[model samples]
Target: MKVKVAKTAGFCFGVQRAVDKVYELIDSSEDPIYTLGPIIHNEEVVKDLENRGVHVTDEDSLEKLPPGSTVVIRSHGVGKAVYDKLDGLKLSYVDVTCPFVLKIHRIVERESAKGAHIVIIGDREHPEVVGIRGWCRGDCTVIKTSAEAEQFNPPAEKQVCVVSQTTFNYNKFKDLVEILGKKRYDNNVLNIFNVLNTICNATEERQKEAKSIAGEVDTMLVVGGRHSSNTQKLFEICKKECENTYYIQTPVDLDSEMFQCSSYVGITAGASTPKKIIEEVQEHVRIKF
Candidate 1:
């Protein structure tokens, strides 16, 4: 069997930078270190951090931190309120929010200040979207699907600005933006609509590469945390191209039987997935072959 692995798979720039910052602090700081959340969606990485005394805390737990504790903001940026709360607690924080996500926050903050209703195209519950919403000075909406896009009905006169989660499927973002363009709120929605494609360049490349590989392979394996949005998007894109697609968090999740009849297999991982995990999965598949 021939095995294909995406060159773009695993740890995009932002995730790598966030992970590196945490490790650096772990080595240099004697203070109690906490991440606002899991540094990345990957459970393996989070568990490793926990082993190294890097505890995970939420917004509600800011007051509970010990004096001199340092909070590390995860790659998924937090809302401005988080900063205020951290300040109120007098705790120091390291902001490792992905630059792509930070850019979206800035855009939302700027546009909302100008009175445009901010519309985010992503899962509402996603930390990044929630953070972006917190930056809006006025009203904000989160739309994740075509149905949501169809059902969206802001006031006709309210100018609307749209941004997407950095990990959102690029094609779907376009489709949703197209749907928004057709909505005739007072027959002037198109003129007032400001759509920004905020999906990161690395995510687009990974998805594009995954699609091409999945189309040519007999089976495809997408590796990442179950909670990872970018990984889920990759699985979706790959499944459409090849029905024999599996989403696995680790090499342990792989079933040798799945490859029994496969002549070619493609492997890809999410942005938060570490290169070691990807390598292990690849090694397991090669052993099976």
Candidate 2:
């Protein structure tokens, strides 16, 4: 059997930077280290950090920490309220939010301040989307499908601004935006309507490459954290092209039985996945089969 691996299968720039920041703090800081959440979505990476004395804390847990403790914000940016609270408590912290996500926060904050109603195209419960909503000073809507867009009804006088989660599927984001655009036109709401494609270029490239590899292989393996949004999107894309696609977090998750007679296998991973995990999966397949 032959094996092919995606060049874009591992950690993207933002995730890598966030992980590096945590390690840097661990090495240099004497105070106990904490993160607002898991520095990245990968469990293996998080577990390793935990073993190194890094603790994960949320908003409710902030008060438990002593005043001088250092906290590192994860790549998924938090709302302005988080910053205000941290400042109020006089805790030292670093903001490691992805640049693309920071751009969405600025857009929503500025547009909503100007009286525009915010519309975010992504999972409503996602940490990134929740953070973006926090920036909206006025009304906001989160829609992930055409049905939600069709059912939405904004105030007639309000202007609208549309943005998306950084890791949302590019094609789905476009579809939802088109549906919302038509709704605005049909209602004859001539207010200032703005649409921003906030999906990161790395995500778009990874999804495109995953699709291509899935089409050419007999089976495809997508590696990443189970709850990772971008990895789930990659799995969906791969599954559509190759019915034999499997989502695995590590080499241990791979089933040798599945690839028994497969002639060609492809491997890809999410933005948060580590290169070592991908290499392990690739080597396992190449050597065992």
Candidate 3:
């Protein structure tokens, strides 16, 4: 069997930076350290970090922290108020928000403050989108598909500024933009239709590479946690390109049914996944198939 692996799979710049911050703090900080969330969505990585002393907490859970503990902000940057709470409590901590995500926060805040209605093109429930919404101090809406963009009921045509969550699907973003563009119906035009390409370059690169690889292989293996949004998106992308694609969290999740007749395999992973997990999947396939 010939196996082709995506060159850009695993540990994107933001995820790598966030994961590194947790490990570094776990080793250096003597006080109990907690992350605003799982740091990233990969449970395997979170479990590993837990074993090394890092803990996970959320916005609501922070109040339960024993006094004087450090709280690490996850890569999905928190709003100003959340950080201010840590300051009020005099908590020692680290902010490991990816520079790319930070830029989106700034963009939404600036645009919203200037009176442009903010629009985020991604899952509303996703932590990254939630964080982006926090930065906008005013009206903001999130829609994941072109149909939702069609139904979006913002105040007026030109009053909206479209921005995307960093990890949103690239092609989908372009489609949403087209949908919004068609809605600028006005002699009554709301006067300002702003579009900010806030999707992270790393995410775009990974998806492009994964799709190209999936298109060429007989079977595709997407590696990362089930809860990882990017990983789930990767699986969907690969499955669309190659119907034989399978999603697995680790080597343990691999199913032989996916490889029964496939000879050419392609592999890719989510930003939150580690390189070792990708390697393990490749090795597992090599040995079994």
State TM-scores per candidate.
0.97, 0.98, 0.96
Q: What is the C-alpha RMSD of each candidate to the true structure, in Å?
A: 1.2, 1.1, 1.5
Off by over 4 Å in 2: none
Q: For model 2, how does the per-residue alpha-carbon lDDT over 1-289 read when each residue is reduced to its tens digit?
A: 7999999999999999999999999899889999998888999999999999999999999989976799998889999999999999999999999999999999999999998999999999888998998888989999998899889886688888999999999989988887777766556756556899999999999999999999999989999999899999999999999999999998888787779669999999999999999999999998987
Predicted candidate 3 versus true structure: per-residue lDDT over 136-200, tens digit per residue:
97898899987898897668543788888888889889999888887676455554678889888
The candidate with the higher lDDT, 1 or 3, is 1
Instruction: For each candidate in the order shown, give its overall lDDT on alpha carbons.
Output: 0.93, 0.92, 0.86
Instruction: Score candidate 1 by TM-score against the native.
Output: 0.97
Instruction: Evaluate candidate 3 by giving its C-alpha RMSD to the native, one decimal.
Output: 1.5
Q: What are the clashing pairs of model 3?
A: 158-190
lDDT of 2: 0.92
Name the weakest run of 10 consecutive residues (lDDT summed) in model 3.
183-192
Query: lDDT tens string, model 1, 34-104?
Result: 99988999999999999999999999888999999999999899999999999888899999999999999
Q: Give the winner by lDDT.
A: 1
Candidate 3 Cα outliers beyond 4 Å, as residue runs: 186-191
Arranged by lDDT with the best first, the candidates are 1, 2, 3
